[model samples]
Target: MSGRFAELHLDQVQRAFGDTVALKGMDLTIKGGEFVALLGPSGCGKSTALNCLAGLLPLTGGRITLDGKRIDDLPPEKRGFGMVFQNYALFPHMSVRRNIGFGLSMRRTGKAELNRRVDEAVRLVQLEEHQHKFPAQLSGGQQQRVAIARAIVLEPPLVLMDEPLSNLDAALRLEMRTEIRRLHQSLGLTTVYVTHDQEEALALADRLVVLRLGEVQQVGSPEEVYAHPVNRYVAGFMGYRNMIPVTVGSQEGEHATVHTEAGVKLVGVKREELGSEAVAAVRPEDFAVVTEIGANTIEAVVEIVEYHGREQAVEARLRDGTQLHVRTNSRLAPGDTITLKVPAERVLVFA
Candidate 1:
C-alpha cells in the first residue's frame, strides 16, 4: 500500500437480486480522510451499498475505485479495510489483546511488532484495564471499543462501520459517537458509516448520502440537507413538520404564496423553481406563538403539550383540522387557542 491515503469513488454502482433491485446507480465520491455516511431508513439499500464497497457483495453494474484503481473485484479479505460490525464481532474465546492482534497475526507479523501495534491500539481506545478480559466480560461499549481497535490496529486507509452503535443504549450510543469522531480526527482514516438513525448520521458524518428505495435522494452536509431538502421524502426524513399539500398562488423571487386545500394561505421560501402544485413544509421551531393573527399567521387550538425540560413540544390543530407541532417555551394548555407565525425564509416549498 502507498503511504498516501486514497479517496473512494463509486461510479453508478448498482446491485440486484434477480428482479428485486436493492441499489440503483449509486454514484458518490469520498475525499481522503473524510467521514461519509450512507443514511436511509430500513430497506433503503444503504447497507447494500456498504456491503458492495466492503467487497462482501459484488456490484451488478458500474464500478468502485479507490484513488482511481478498481477495487470492486477484490475479496473482502483483500480490501484492506477495517470493519466495525453492529454486534462487535469479536471472538468469544479470545482475550481483548488477542482479538485486537488477530489481523496482524493473520498477516504473520513478528511477535515484537504485533505486540507493539496491538498495545498502541488498545491505548488509543482507552481499554488499558480491560485488555485481559474476554468478549463476554466487557461492557457493550468496551467490546465495541475492542472491535474498533481490531479494525484500526492494521491502520487501514479506509474504515467501514455498519450500524456500529445500534446495539448500545441511547446514552452509550451518544458516548460512542463522540469516541468515533475523536478516533476519526486522530487517525485521519477515510471512513464510510452505514446507519438508519438520522440523529447519529447528522451528528457523526461530514457528509450524508441519503438513499431511498434503491436510489440516492440527496447528498450534502448535515446543515444543508436539514435546512433545505430537495423533495418531500427527504424533508420529512430530515425532521421537517407541516408537510401539507398546497396550491401556489404567486411567487416573488424565492418567496411563494400558497394556500392549503382548506383555503388557508401560507407563505414560504422556495430554493428551486416551484410549480403550482407543491408541498409546504416548516420545522417545529420555525414557528412562533403570537398573540394575534395577521398575514401568514395560523390560528390553532392546542391539543397536546409535551414538556421537554428546556423546551415544550406543543401539538395544535387549526380551524380546518390541520395538525401542527411547534417547539417553544410558551406555556400552553390543551384547550387554549394560540396563533403561530411562520417566517417566509424559515419555510420550505418543495415541488
Candidate 2:
C-alpha cells in the first residue's frame, strides 16, 4: 500500500446538535492501512466521529484531513470510503452477487469488469456458495459477510465499520472478529471501527482511541491502555474491578503506601503525581488468595463466589468495608475468611 493513502488525520474535530455537544476538540492520527477502533460507551460520540470522517455528519468545529488534505467539506459519496453498518444494509430483493456489484454498476463500469469484481468479492467473503441467494435466504452471519463484501468490492482506500458484529450471537461474533482481522491483514485497507464492546476493541484494533462524554480519554495500543490506564475512568473501563479510595500515606522510593478507609495499607506504584488522596485500582486477576498476611495483604470476608468455568471470581469485603475481587482456580465458599494479597506491581494508583 502507498504511504499517502495509508494516513488519516483528525484535527481537533468537534460536533454539536443545537445546544448539546456531541464531540469536543477531538484529535487523532491513524496510519494508512492500520486498523483503528474508536471505543466508548453509548452516547459517547464514537459514531459521530466516524460520521465526520465519512462526511455523513458535518463538524460543528475543527477540521478533518486525509493524507494531509482537508476533506471535511466533501460529501459522503465523494469521499471514496466504504462504510459497513450494524444492520448490514443489503437490498432484500438483490442476490449476493448483485449486491456486491451495485457500487460498480452505479459507477457505469462495463458488465464484464463488474462480473469479475463481483465474483472476486464473493470469493473474498467466502460467499460464493450463496452468491445466487437473496438476503432473506441467508443467515445473519452470511448476510453480514455479504455486506462486508459489498463494502470492499468498491476497492475504497478506507473502510469504516460501526459495530458490524453487534447483531451476531456470542459464538458467531467471536468467529466474525477473527474473520475481520484476517481480512484487514490481507487487504491492507485503512479502517476506522466504532464499538462499545471492549473485547472487540482489544481483539480487532491495531490501536484504540477511548472516548468518554465527547472527550478523548486515552489513545494507545491495547496492552498500553490496559496495563497502564491514565485515570480511574480508564482503569474501570478496562475491567479493573477493585477501585478503592485511599489516602496517600507515604511515598518512599518507587512505592507508595495507600491507606484505605477500612484501615488496610495497600502498597502500589504511582505512575502519576497523586496528592494526599487518590484512588487505587486493582485487577481481579492480580490478587491471589494466600494464607499469610504480607505488606499488601488485606483480610476480608468472602461475600460471594462465582464459578465462571475457567476461573472462580471471589468477591470479598475488607476490614475497612472495601469490596475486593479476586480471580483464582481455588474454590472458596461464601462467608469464608481469606487474605487477599495484591501484588504491588499490579496495583495502579490514580488521582
Candidate 3:
C-alpha cells in the first residue's frame, strides 16, 4: 500500500447519546502511514471515537475528512476502511478461506482475482495449512489471525482496530502484538488502533491519543506521554506510582519547588502553582534504595515483596502513614527497613 496512504483529519468531531456525551469536540490529524493508538480506560470514549471514525457511529457535530474529502457522510462500505473487532467476528459456518474472501465476494470481484487475494492473505497470516478449516476448529489466536487477514485482504488505505487482542491469553496477546506491529510496519498503512491496555498501546503505537471522560487528555509519542504527563490523571494512567502530596513553595523557569509531607524540600514536576498543595507523581523504577539516609531520603518499613522477572516490587509505608510502592532489584523481607532516594528530576507535581 505504498503511496496509497491518505491523511485523515477528524475536526471537532462530537458524538453524544442524549444525556451522555461520548466524544465532545474531538480533533485529531493522522499522518499518512503512521500508527496511532487511542488509549483510555473503559467508558472514556476511545472506542466511541473509533466507532465514529469507522462510520459505525455517526458524529453529532463537526466533520471527518480523508485526503481533503468528507467521509463521515459515507456509509461504512463506501468508506473503504478495514475494521477488526475484539471478538474476531468470524462466521462459524464459513471456512477460513471463505471468511477471508468474504469482503471481495461482497464487491463481486472476479473469481481469479478473489482466489489470488485470498491465497495471499492466507499466506500472509501464516494460516496456509488451515485454509480449509472452520472457525470452530481453529484456536483463538488462529481465529484472530483470520480476522486480521480478512481485514487486510481488501487492501484498504486505513485500518481500524478495537482491542483486537483483548480476547486472547497473555502469552498469545504478547505474540500477536509483535506480529501486528510487524505487519503494520511492512504494509505502511495508516492504522488507528483503539485499546485500553496501556502496555499494548505503548508497545505498538507510533503515537498515543489518551482520552478521559469524552475528552482528549494528551497526544504525543509514547515516550513523550510516558515521560511528561500533563496532569495527575494522565500520570496515574501512565503508571506513576508515587504521588507525594506537597505544598508549592515557589516557581521558576519550567519547574516548581515544593515541600514534601516528610519535611523535605525538592524540585518536583510542578508546571505552575496548583494552589497551595499539589501531588507529585513519581515512577516506582525511579526510586533507588540507598545505604545512607540524608536529606530527601525517606525511611520506611517494608510491608511485602513481589518479584518480577526483571525487577522487584516493594511495598513500604512511611512513619507518617503514607503508602509507597518502590521497584528495585534488591530482595527485601517483611520486617526490613529501607531508605528510598527520590530524585527531583524524575518527579512530576500536579494539582
Where in model 3 is the C-alpha error above 4 Å? 1-3
C-alpha root-mean-square deviation, each candidate: 1.4, 1.7, 1.7
Position 298, candidate 2: lDDT: 83
Residue 247, model 1: lDDT of 93
Tell me the tens digit of each residue's lDDT in model 1 across 63-148: 99888899899998888888898888899999999999999999999999999999999999999999999999999999999999
The TM-score that candidate 3 achieves is 0.96
TM-score of each: 0.96, 0.96, 0.96
List candidate 2 stretches off by more than 4 Å.
Answer: 1-4
Candidate 1's C-alpha runs over 4 A off are: 1-3
Q: lDDT of all the models against the reference?
A: 0.90, 0.89, 0.89
Worst 10 residues of 1 by lDDT: 1-10
Best by lDDT: 1
Q: Write the per-residue lDDT of candidate 3 for residues 46-147, one digit (tens) a residue.
A: 999988988999899999998898999988888878889989899999999999999999989999999999999999999999999999999999999999
**Location of the lowest summed lDDT over 10 successive residues in candidate 3:** 1-10
